[model samples]
Every structure is written in structure tokens, then in C-alpha cells.
Target chain A: MDERERSEMETRARLVAAYDAMSPSAEVTDRVLARLRDDARVPEKKRKSVEPDSRSALRFGLFLLPLAACVVAAAILLRPSAMMPTATKVSQEEVVVEETVDAASSDAAVAGDASVEVAEEAEGLAPQATKSEAAEADAAAGAESREPLCELYPIVVTPEGRELRVGDVYAGKFDDVRPEESVAFSEDGKRSVACELIERDGALFVRYGDSADWRFAS
Target chain B: MAIDLEAVFRRHFATVYRLCYSYLGSASDAEDAAQSVFLKLLNHPREFADSEHEKAWLIVCASNHCKDELKSARRTRVVSMGERLDASLGATDHLDETIDAVLKLPPKYKDCVYLYYYEGYKTAEVADMLGIPASTVRNRLRKARALLKDSLGGS
Candidate 1:
């Protein structure tokens, strides 16, 4: 090789020597391996409970048959039929759904006063005058009581814009509600809607079949 | 037989680290890039035809990863000024001058030069690792050598 070629070759050798010397510290390897070990220890996929066999599935279905029938019956009874007239009808009954603010406000005009409206509405289909009297008495006591009254409307409604029947169990969230003040409404023998309000969580949450993680209104 | 990851890591970590260090001027970024390449191996252990293929696979992985890293906004914001030479190696003026000149070359030429000279990869091998044409790799090396020679005062 010529003089310049030899010099260039020597320069390339030196550059390689410099780069070959550059490697990370040993600690990086140790840390990486330790992380990998931890990863290997834990399962990559979630462990699922064993699935039931066909016979078990059949048995479970059979067990739930009666309950399923009851739910079906309830749904049939609660189905909004143009031919069916609601048992409890007040001069003005509004349906309030929390998510729809416009519906809540419009319904608020009809179902506004808990004492007057609930009693008046209950009197129409309530089995006994005494039942209405007792509910009215409760309303009167609340009329004088210094506790905050929260008007709860079923979040779910029939397509015909009606509230759930008194005996129907509601499964949903409540916003700005006390569980205790919360009531699961049922109809009296007179077919009038009435609430069986129970105190829960310092009268904060109304117990509906079971407590759920409720997503409150933002 | 299954591939031994520990042996692979031991054998190729320095080359991978240096490749990344060349692409990304920062030592820390190079370390991260090297570790990430190894992590990818852990996640999906690929089978190679032979030791040469395994080494080529690593070089390709490291080269592609560093190319992506350089394209990122983080790399743009934090440009590593120069090579972080090993303290022992930096003591020699000639080695330091040559390395500094090589690092100063544009990324395209710098990569070609490193693979060609430092890693002892032929022009075609460098092209294969970089996913470029052999002619392009030769051109880059030619341009890089000319630049280095000019910068090093005919040496």
C-alpha cells in the first residue's frame, strides 16, 4: 500500500479500538436480569377459574329456571302496553332519570312535593285508606322534620315513559343520594305505588337488593 | 437445544452497546438502547442459523433501534455532543482525535464507518445490517473516510 493508504488504515484501526472499549457498567446487566426474574415469577396471563362442565351448566340453569320464570313474568307484567292502564295515576306523574337532566326537570314539575304528590298519587290505587293515611302521616312527619328530602326516580324506565312497578327491584346507580333515605318502591294491594324507605349509611344509601360501586354524577 | 440468553448477552452486549453509542452520541441513551434490544430478545427469543447469523441479527436489531431512537423528538431535544470515550482509551491523543473525528461525521456516514472499520463488517454486510444498498454503504464509507482524512490532516 502507498503512504496515504497505510496512514488511513492506521487511523481506522485506532477508531475501532476506541469504540471497542466502550461498554456499559456491569450494574445495568444485573438490574435487567433481576427485572426479568421478577417478570418470570409472575404469570404473564391471568389465571382463570376452571369452567363448569356441561352437566354443571345444565344443573345451574335448572336451579335458576324458577327465578328466570319470575323475572320473565315480572317483565311481562311491567311491559308498557297501550291497552294496559297504570294502576297508580296522579293528576301529574313525571318520570325522572338522572342522566337526562331535561327529563328530571320536566318530571320534577309533576313529582316535586314528596308529601303532597306521593300521598295524592298513592291515594288513587292504595288498597286501604289506612295505608294512605299511614304514608301521609310519614309524609307529614317529614313535612315537619328538618332532614333533607331527596327525590329518587328510577334511572331505568319503560319505553312508554313510566316508572318501575312498586314490587320491581331496581339495579342501578344513584347520584347525590343517601342509602338510608333511599327507598325500594312497591305497590299496595290497591295497586298504588308506595316506597318502603329504610335507613342505611346514616340514611345516606337506600338498599336496593345489594350495594354496588355507583358511578356518581360528575 | 434451546438458545442460552445469558451467553448471548455476554458475547454481544459490548458490540450492541457500542453500535448504539455510535448512533446515539449519549452513553446513557446507548445503554438504554442496548438494554432494550436485549429485552426484545428475552420477550421473543429468535432462532438463528449460526453464530454469524446471531451476531448479524444483533447488529441489525441494534442499528434499527438506534435509527428509531435518533428519529424521536427526545433524541432531537437532547443531542449528545460527542462520544463518551472510555477513560483509559481517552488518555491517548491519537485514538481520541480519530474517534472524535469519526463521531463528528453525519449519522449516515458515521454508522457505515463504525460497522465497516470498528465492528469489522464488510461493505455489503454493513448494507445488509442497515437495510441499505451496498453501493450506498460504499458511498457513505468513501465520504466518511475522505471527511476523516481531511479532518485528521491527511492521516
Candidate 2:
């Protein structure tokens, strides 16, 4: 407000004069000093407890907040859903995956069970084909040897709340994946059922049960 | 070392008493409120940065205490300037009337009016002392002046 200060008015002067005339009576000062002296014996620690304020509580709550966030993040991070995809290739013979080529058009599984036999056949050193044919067989064996590994995290909405748990880790390529699918939304495995891996547009997807919608692996 | 209570009491007793009196408009009750504020200072001692900080803390506490005393059920209608101050002013009509009018204004407005008019503090200085924004102090003073205009008579 740009209003002019009403300084020179008689009312202001009168107010100034009246308040100027007043002072704390001697009786009040004596009483206050006496009271302070009488109570000064108590320790500061004891005095603080008697008069509690919200500032300490507010500070404590603020301090614990970041720690709480870190704990929750750690818990979530420990689950495989937060794990970044690693490019550690497993040779075909070293892997113990049970492969099947069921529902050939829809199922996306790397059915490289022929890889072991093909390796053995190539190693036998029997005269079977021309050099061109040997090259074709070696090429086919190489394609079946290295399959990328993928893991999935499936969640189901339950009565309590949404739960995120590791479904299973499967070793397969986007070209094909066939694994025995099972799930337990709770302690009991009631929700566990058959699932089929589907490949579409170069991304691996899974469909659990007949009624469940096809979901992309995350 | 702890603050020198005797010196502080001597220096600030009147200013605190004056502020409480402005809000409460009664000498005896203002005494009680002022005592309570200083008692708080004694009970819970704080490390002050400077003399201004010490004085500001007392003034703010006294203001809060006076507002509380007025809000408490024991306080009824605000007491007028009455015979004690009137005789002290030698029966000055305008000052007595203005003092009474200022006491009638709410404590929020009364704080600015008292600090600005009697204490001779600038608006920004009053805001710093009261721990409020300067604009808020100015707004309160404007409203307080408007309230006092009836008795102050447009001037």
C-alpha cells in the first residue's frame, strides 16, 4: 500500500505520549526475577522434556524419509524384474533346456535339440557329402548353438493387491520358445497353468491359460 | 555465558509491557503477560545472534502472549485508557481516544500500529521484528489506519 504515513497527527502524538508514560511496575519486575531465580535450579534437560514442540518430531520424520525410500527401492531391485538383460551366451550342449516344437506357427521356441546330434555327426569324420554340403551343415549347427536368454515377470491382480514375482527364467530366442509354464499367485499354485510363448514382430510374448490375454515378456 | 538477565530485564521490561498494554489495554493484565514472556526467556534460554535478535524474540513472544491473553476466556471486553493514563496524559482527549481506538483494533493490526507509531520503526523493520513479510506489515498498517480513521479524523 502506497498510503501516506499519518505521523504528525495529534492522535499519533497522543498515543506515543500515552504509551511512553507506561512502564512495567517495580512490583512486576521483582516478582519476575524472584520467579526466575526460584526455578533456575532445574536442569535444562529436565526443562526441555516438560515443554515438547513439533520441530523435533518434524526433523526426525524428514531424516527417516530418504532411508525409507532406499529400503523400498532395494527390496524392489532385488527382484529379477529390475535386473538388466545380460548378454552371456550359453553353448547349445551346455544348456539343459527340454525343447519341443509344438503349435509350430504360434509357439516361439528355440528347439535346438538337433544341435548335439549335428555336432556329433560333423565330428564323426564320415564321408557323407560334398564340401558345399558340409558348409551348409556347419552353418545350421552354428545357428542352433547360440540362443539368447530371456526372463519374465508376470503379475496377477489379487484380492489383497498387485504382486510382482519372478515367473521363471527361460533360455530361448525370439524365433521359438517352448517351456512348461507354471505360476502361483499366492502360496497355493492354483493360478499355475499351461502357457505358450508367441513371437510377433520380433518380440517374445506369452499366453497363460486359454482365457489369459497374450502378454509381452518384461 | 548465559545472557545477563538483570540488564535484559531492565532494558526490555518497558517495551514488552508497552506492547502488551497496547493489545490488552489493561495495566495489571499487561504486567502478567509481560512477566510470562520474560519467564519463558529465563526458562528456555536461547543463543542470540545479537541484541536485535534478543529484542526481536522478546517482542514477538510478548505479542503472541498478549494475543493469547486476549483470546483466553478470562478476558472480556477490552478495557479503555481509563483514569490512570488519562491523568498521566493530563486529560489529553485525542491521545486517550486514539489509544482506546488502537486497543479496539484486532491484535494483528494493533501490532503494526504500535510498532510503527510509538516505536518509530519503518514498515520493513516492523516486519523483520514481527517475523512477517514487509508487504504484510504494510497491509496490516493500512487496515489499522483505516480502523483508527474514525477517531484520528481523516488525518
Candidate 3:
């Protein structure tokens, strides 16, 4: 070997010798072992296998309550319109006739001395009553214009029984109503009663406001 | 499955303690760090993948802990130069002079010298253990040898 290599080897040897001569502490192993044993024994209670059944049951019940509530809330939000029914429909022609007759009676009552003259005029022109007819038609048209637009369709109350209709008059109550669905009334049934219509999930529901239940709107 | 802590302690305690002592140059700190190492093993016994892994981890952990203690001691001004010199000397005569020369060398050179000679690690193994490039280890070792030779009166 070269002198440099020899010198390096000698240095390594001397350092190793110095290290070997120095003794380690005698109690180090004992101290380490004691600590390990202490660690293994602590927390013994947490490792026990026999927990009480009642405590476990209580924990399980608590966990399931929130899960059950979440399922119910999801169901309600997904099907909001399945809660009510639609209102009855009123025809514009009938409303106009009723307003015309009422206006004529009021006019006769106010024109007290002219009442005889108006009645005579009414009788003679009852047959050729073109002028009166035109006046009645105008009056009917004005009354129809004054009626609320929401009164044309059924009103739908929310599932919480809150009124969902836009009109002031309540149409009717409905059962199992859903939002966005249309309701149809029977041919002979009164079409003017306020009905609650709930539309949900591409289907319409109709029910009367006074009733406790709803039917699918046809 | 839980590890056989007693068996592991019995098998490697001496080596681990010795490694810590060499790193810290103090018996008290070595013992404390050694105990801490075993305590850590007890808490998380499944960390080691195999026997070799466990041994390597213990050495690394103990070494790191000892270095931290040394840093704290220095910061607190509790690390007396005379005491360190005496501890490094142990039973060796004229160790003060030898260590003074070693200490005068740069820290990188000193680490290579101490691990190679004082700790009895091979150059390649020391390189792997310290996570340094092997060429760097070679250069440090060469530089330390030159410095030591000059200090020790070698031509």
C-alpha cells in the first residue's frame, strides 16, 4: 500500500481503539427495559374487551337518530308538491252575466222617479234591446277586468299548510299534493270554489281548500 | 401481532446505547436517549418492517436525539469544553491534545473522521448512513486525514 493509504488505515485503527476502550453505562439496558414495561402496562383500561351492552346500545341509537332525520328531510325536499290540490275554475261568461244584472238593478234603485220610465223602456225594448245589451256587455267586460287573475287557477298551499296560491281567495284544500301539476274538475261540480293545487315532479294535484285531502289533477 | 419487546431489548440494547454514547460523547445523554428509543418502540411497536429495519431506525433515532441534546446543551452554555474533552478522552492519555486538534478541523471533516475511525463505520457505509454522496465522504475523509497527520506530527 502507499504511505497515504497506510496512514489512513492507522488513523481508523487508533480511533476505533479509543472507542473500544471507553465503556458504556451499565444501567442503560435496565432503564430502557423498565420504560418499555411501564408503557405496555399503562392504558390497560382502554384495551379491555368487555364493554357494557347498554352503553354500546345507547351509542348506536344516538348515531342512528341523525341518520333517520336526514332521510326524512331529503324525502320532503325532493317531493314538495305532493302536498295539496288545485282550485275550481270559474267561467268568464257567467261572471259577466252576474255583474250586468247587478248593475241594472242598482241603476233602477238609484233613479227612483225614473224607475217607472226605465221599466217601461225595459219592457218595450226587452225584445229589440240592442242598446241595453251593448251597455250590459260593456259593464260585464269592466267587471271581468277588475277580478284577480290568480282566481282563474287553483291555489296550492305548501305541505306545512302555508297558502301557496297567488290569489286572495282560497280555492280549496288538497291531499298528497305535488307542485307544478294541473287539476281538472268534474263536469257538474262547482268550478268556482277556491282549490289548492300543488305542482311537483312534472305532475299537478288539485284539492279544495276546505277538504283535508288531495287528488291528482287530471 | 405485538412485538417481543424484551427479546428485542436484550439483543440490541448494548449496540444502540454504544452508538448513542459515541454520537453524544456522554454516557448520561446516551442512556436517556436509549431509554427513549425503547419507549418509542413500545408505544408503536409495529413501525419496523424487519430486524434490519428496526436496528437502522434505532441507530438513526438515537443519533438524532443525541445531536438535539448536544445542541440544547451548547445553547444553554452547559456544555463545558473541559468536560467534553474529558469525556472524549475517557481513559486515553493526551486525549485533550488529540481532540483539540480534531475539534479544530471543520465540522464536515470531523464527522467523517469520527464516524470512520471513532465509530468504526466503513467509508461506504458511513456515506449511506449519513445520506451524503460517497465522493463527499471520500473527500472529507482525505481532508481530515491530512489535518490529523499535520497535527499529530506525521509528515
Candidate 4:
């Protein structure tokens, strides 16, 4: 090799040696595993489906509580006309769901199933859980827009149109926030955000959440 | 793909930590960045075609995370703990000068040069690993060499 080439080789050798001299803390593996265990506590996943059993439904119901009002208001606003598009969105999500299933299940997945099992064991022993501690299975793997929060909670509207599951909305603060159903509501600007849609008196008002203040738009 | 975390971490941790150190210039920050990369993998698990794809995913993820960290408001650049340890352990006198030069290269060139030269991957392999064109990798490597040579006393 010429002088230029020799110098390049020398530089490469020195840099490589410098890099080799370095190593991570011995506890890196333990640190990472520990962090995963901690995050699994919040359990950032939705069930594969709303199970037929009451226990699963009740467990899942806790997450869906926040979305009830927003969904109902949307349903009222968008019944016969909005039906077609919502159906289309579901189909699109179905396609995403299919893709993610093959990718996630067929490919080696990570850290969630064991977590779920641990959660189930906890659930059996405890009989009750604080919402954050509740272990939930994650699905809708590929779609960024999908909210695992459910259809989880009670949005049951009485015949007189009162008590629309006010409070306790828990749409997660995802890194990539793709709002599922955006109303004219813009509390802190989350699209299709989790909010309480209250029918107070005769007029309706919206309460935006799993964070931010109550926003009212009649 | 069966994700054995211990296996994957053992395989990729050095590379990830090195890349992070190169970017952040601090061993503690590099370790933090490296852990975040693995945590992301655990959180958003994806199917890789093979080990190559897995490595590529990690390089990209680590690069992105480092860039974000650099851009964040709270970012503080500290001296490399590894560099200090290397000196304390009595690396050759020129080692620090060479490292400082390597660190001076732009981030893109730094990655290409490190993978191409230090990591000892061929140009085409570096291209594949970086998801960039071989020509682009070659170009970066060429530019990196010129830059290195300029500092290290060669044409």
C-alpha cells in the first residue's frame, strides 16, 4: 500500500482498538431486563379481542371507561351517514391486524406473553387490581392509529340520556399519537382523543382527556 | 423469530454501545442510549428476516435515538469515560489524537467510517447494514478517508 493507503490503515487500526477498549457496564443485560419488567407493569397492550367471559370483559372494561362518552357522542352525530366510513376504517384496521399477527406471531416476539402470564397469576391471587397495575394483552400490532384502550369500558347511555360514564378515560400517551375519532373537540390537540361527552341539562359538552383539561364544545 | 433477549443483547450490545458512544461521546450516555434501543425492541418487536436485518434495525434505531437525544433540550455533552479509561490503561500516545479526529467527522461520515473501517465491514456490507446505496457508502467512506488523511498527516 502507498503512503495514503498506509495512513488510512493505521487510522482504522487505531480507531478499532479504541472502540475495542470500551465495554458497557456489566449490568447492562440486567438493567435492560429490569426496565422491561417495570414497563410491563403498565402493560402497554390491548387484548386480542373482547373475550366472551365476564371476568375478561370486566377486566377489559376498566380501560374502555374513558372512551365511552366520546364514542356515544360520535355515534349520535354519525349514525346512518357515518356508518359506511366507520365500517371502512374497521376493514382497514382488520388488514393491519392481519399483517401484524403474521409478523408478530410468526416472527419471534418479545417479552409480552410471559408478562401476561405473570399478570394472570397476579389477577387470580388478588381478585382486584388498580387500573394501572392491571395486566392487559397487546394486539393490533402494526397499526399506529389503533387504541388498545378499548372499547374497554362502560359507555352505557341510559334511556333518559344521563350518566354517560363520566370520568376515568385512559387513552394512553403513545409516542406516535394517531387519534381514532377526532371531534370538533381540541383539548390540548389530541385527535380522536379520550374525553367525557356529557349530556348536561339538554345540551352536550365534551371533556378531553387521558390528560389535559375539560374542553367544552356544544 | 424467537426473541431470546440475552442472546440478542450479547450479539448487538457492543455495536450499539460503540455507536452510541461515538455519537454521545460519553460512556454513561452511550450505555443509556444502548439500553433505550433494546427497550424499544422489546416494546415494538418486529420480524427480522435474519441476523443482518436485526443488526441493521439496531443501527438505525440507535442512530435515531442518539439524534433525538442530541436535539433534546436537556442534552449535555460530557467527555468519554471510555477514552479516559483507555488513557489511564496506557493506550499508545497517538490514540487520543486519532480518536479526537475520528470523533470530529460529521455524524453520517462517522457511522460510515466506523462501520467500514473500525468495525471492518466492506463498503457493500456497510451499505447493506446502513440501508444506504453502496455508492453512497463508498462516497461517504471516500470523504471520510480524505478527512482522516488530512488530519493524520497523509495525502
What DockQ values do the models have? 0.23, 0.26, 0.17, 0.19
For model 3, residues A50-90, the per-residue Cα lDDT tens digits are 23477467668778889999998789867634343222222
Ten contiguous residues minimizing lDDT sum, candidate 3 chain A: A84-93
Could you tell me how far off, in angstroms, the CA of residue A34 lies in candidate 2 after the best superposition? 4.4
Top candidate on lDDT is 2
Candidate 2, what DockQ?
0.26
RMSD (Cα, Å) of candidate 2?
16.8
> What is candidate 4's lDDT per residue for A175-203, written digit by digit as tens?
22223322233333333344444444354
Per-prediction backbone clash count: 10, 5, 44, 11
- Across all candidates, the chain A TM-score values are 0.19, 0.26, 0.22, 0.21
What range of 10 consecutive residues in model 2 chain A has the weakest lDDT sum? Answer: A96-105
Tens-digit lDDT string for candidate 2 (B14-133):
888889878777777777677678778877778789877888889899999888777754456645546336343454565566666766788888778878888788999998888899
Q: What global local distance difference test value does model 1 have?
A: 0.58
Residue A22, candidate 4: Cα error in Å is 3.2
**Which regions of candidate 2 fall more than 4 Å away from where they truly are?**
A1-12, A25-218, B1-3, B77-91
The docking category that best describes candidate 3 is: incorrect
lDDT of 1 by residue, A109-214 (tens): 5767444554344334322234335344344334233122334443435335546544554444333333334443543333323232432322322322111112
* Cα error, candidate 4, residue A47 (Å): 17
Ten-residue region with minimum lDDT total, candidate 4 chain A: A131-140
For model 4, the DockQ equals: 0.19
- Superposed Cα deviation of residue B80, candidate 1 (Å): 6.1
